[model samples]
Target: MKKIRNFCIIAHIDHGKSTLADRLLEFTKTVSQREMQAQLLDNMDLERERGITIKSHAIQMNYVYKGEEYILNLIDTPGHVDFSYEVSRSIAACEGALLLVDASQGTEAQTISNLYLAINHDLVIIPVLNKIDLPGAMPEEIKDEMVDLLGCDRGDIIPASGKEGIGIEDILNAIVERIPAPVGNPDGPLQALIFDSVFNSYRGIEVIFRVKNGSIRKGDKVKFMATGKEYIADEIGTLGLQQIPKQVVECGDVGYLISGIKVAKEVKVGDTFTHIDRPASEAIVGFSEVKPMVFAGIYPVDTSEFEELREAMEKLQLNDAALVWEPETSAALGFGFRCGFLGMLHMEIVQERLEREFDMTVITTVPSVQFRVLTTKEKLLNISAPSEMPEPNFIKYIEEPYINAQIITKSDYIGPILNLCMDKRGILKNQIYLTAERVELQFLIPLAEVVFDFFDKLKTISRGYASLDYELAGYQESDMVKLDVMLNGEAVDALSAIVHRSKSYEWGKKLCEKLRELIPRQMFEIAIQAAIGQKIIARETVKAMRKDVLAKCYGGDISRKRKLLEKQKKGKKRMRQVGSVEIPQEAFMAVLKIN
Candidate 1:
């Protein structure tokens, strides 16, 4: 155990974490040069295309130093704030972390957030200044920032460049010397923490875990602490380029256990696995269940594919425990599933995967945050979709979730960023100057505001230099009301949204204008109105299409033409009184894009 090190790499997005991992794999000779690829740990095609890590991956490497063999287990974690929960879980399974900071960009919002997470996990954090080979690299300034933020000695910081393969040996040596070895009782009852899981069609559910205590072997009967389900371990292995089977995975080691459980819901991320015959007395501490923050309805464009979409979601849930979904029907979009996700990026990734991998085309409703509703009779209910909301008279009040948001950016663009935040009803919490050029600002904003295009706007206002990170700060009482879109006297449930009462007029006006552009003109005029309760706050009309009813009356009497025109006008009046508008799919999608 003295020669074994279990650690992970944590960083902000696009900071070369995966590149550094690739270099480490090369130096450790884990994969041959001929078979190596870029961002080896980022196995997902979407991750590769987007240049981001979406999932946590673990790999075991063997290295020899000073004539002594050492076992190093490196777990690569996602760098985005949307996957912070995955980062925390990965940190919990390790003994140390390599804090990678870009020498050019220095510290970012997510970098600070990940550093705190590593500190909370009580892991040995070895700060590494990466990308020293870049033209804009400033190692001295980045070193100072790291020391100030981490409160560590200047001599402890290591400088390296992932692209140039510089300082690779130094990083390896530091991992061996600075990071402590994992300490656990091999003789104790079996206890392992499941950090992640994947579904295999033939092998059942394969769980990736860290052996906190005791050992697991093939054919062992294991029980999940949370679910109390027993399954025989079909195989035990370590993750290489592929699964390398082993007879036993001892304590203080990271590996995969193949349990003969075909159902994904049977296994959870934070659950503990123990030998059924000699189970541990208690489960490990700090087991946090993943919660969904944003909710939306996903409907198949072809209603016949509804069951296919449902099956696809079920299969996806087996792999992504963070995903939650249930059957839902929309008046406009028809039957579908209301799905919950960690955030907007997660929601988008899921949608993309469903389209690309499952070959299913789907229509997604506007995303919403879960709201707490208090009824007149003093009943409390949770609502995820606007359609789920009770009548206006039945509710006493509503509470919306809020987040503690932190942003890091240069000082030059503070004015526009502040204005943007204020427009979103943000309440400033605190501000700090990280350096002469950079500033860190905090705010308490509604989660609904941040989940939608807020990050994109922040980047645009700050010239793509701003980084944001946020945490849920619980729900707060606010003056929020449901804003409904009415088309030809009918309320479109899919277009309904909850907004702050103060901004209702502006939002209603903007929504009405957007719908007018999206909805096509019909034979009769279509009145597009935005309403709060029964009162219309904004309205726009799509003029009826005109037809020359008397164009074919050439050489006929003028009176004949007049009679034909009068008859056509009466027909149009009747059509206006009884005709219902048919909104196309493009209009539904267009309204969702309205900011």
Candidate 2:
């Protein structure tokens, strides 16, 4: 047990975490040269194309030091804030973390946040400065920053470049020397924690777990603690370039278990597995529960495929435990599931995965943040969608979710960043200068404000230098109203949004104009109106497509032309009464595009 070291890599996005991971694998000879490639851990195509890691990948490495062989279990994690839940789960399973910081960029918001997560789990943190090969690398300055942040000695910080393969030996030595080994008794009853799982069409659900106590062997009777279901362990294996099956996986090791469990819903991430005959006293306590920041509806393009969509979602949940969903029906969009996502990016990835992996074509509604409502009857309700909001007359007050946002950027952009935050109803909470060149500004802003275009705008204004990390700060009373969009005077529940009363007028105007451009023109005029209850604040008209009625009247009398025009006008009026507008898919997406 003392020979096994479990660790993971944590960093901000684009900070060479994956690149460093690749170098580690190469140095340990875990992956051969012919089989190795860039971002080897990020096997997903979407991850490679976007130049980011979306999932946490686990692999084992064997290394010999001081004439002794040591087992190293490495889990590579995503860097984006949206995938922080993945980082947290990986951190929970490991005993130490490699905190990689970009030398040129220094430590950003996500770096600080992820470091805090690792610290909370009481994991040993090894600070490593990456990208030293870059021309703009500032090893000395970043080292000082690390000293201030981590309060560790200057000599302890390791400067390395993943691209140039520098400090690989130092990092390996640090992991073995600094990080502690897993502590468990092989004689104890079986106790294993399932960190992640994936579905297979041919075999069944493959569960990836770390043995906390005792051991698991092939053909052992395993019971999932949460589900209370029993199954025979068909195969047990450790993860490598490929899953290498083993007859036994003892304590302090991570491996995969396949048991002919075909149902995706049966396997739960973070659940505990024990021997059915000699089970552990209790299940292992898992990581913190996932808190979703954004809520959106996902519906199949074809209504009849609702069941198929549900099954797809079930399988996806097995892969992504952070995704929370419940069945719901919309008056306009029909039946669908209301999904809670970590952020907009998380929602986009889920939608894309549904299409690419499950072959499910889906339409996602406008995203909204959760709201708290109190009615005159003294009943409180939690509202995720605007359609669930009570009538204006019955509501007493509304509270919106707020977040504590931290922005790290160069001093030159502080003015613009502050202005953007203030425009989003953000209140400045604190500001501190980590250095003369870098500043960190803190704000308290409503979560709903950032759900749309705040991040994109911040990136644009800062010229891609600003990094943001935020956490829910709880709820506060706000003058909030439900803004509804109506097409041809009929309310479309899918387009409704909960906005602050002060900004509702401006938001309504922008939404109406956006819908006017996105909704296709039909035989009849489509009046796009944005209203709060019965009061219409903004309206736009999409004119009907008209055919020239007088084109056939060549060299005709004025009376003839007049009669033809009058007949055509009457026919158009009748068509307007009978014709219905077809809301294009882009119209639903226009809500996100509205500035």
Question: What ranges in model 1 sit over 4 Å off?
Answer: 545-547, 569-582
Instruction: Encode model 2's per-residue lDDT on 402-483: one tens digit a residue.
Output: 9999999999999999999999999999999999999999999999999999999999999999999999999999999999
TM-score of each: 0.96, 0.98
Please, what are the lDDT tens digits per residue for candidate 1 over residues 416-453?
98999998999989989999999999999999887788
Among these predictions, the greatest TM-score belongs to: 2
Error of 1 at 410 (Å): 1.1
Number of backbone collisions per candidate:
0, 0
lDDT of each model, Cα atoms only? 0.89, 0.94
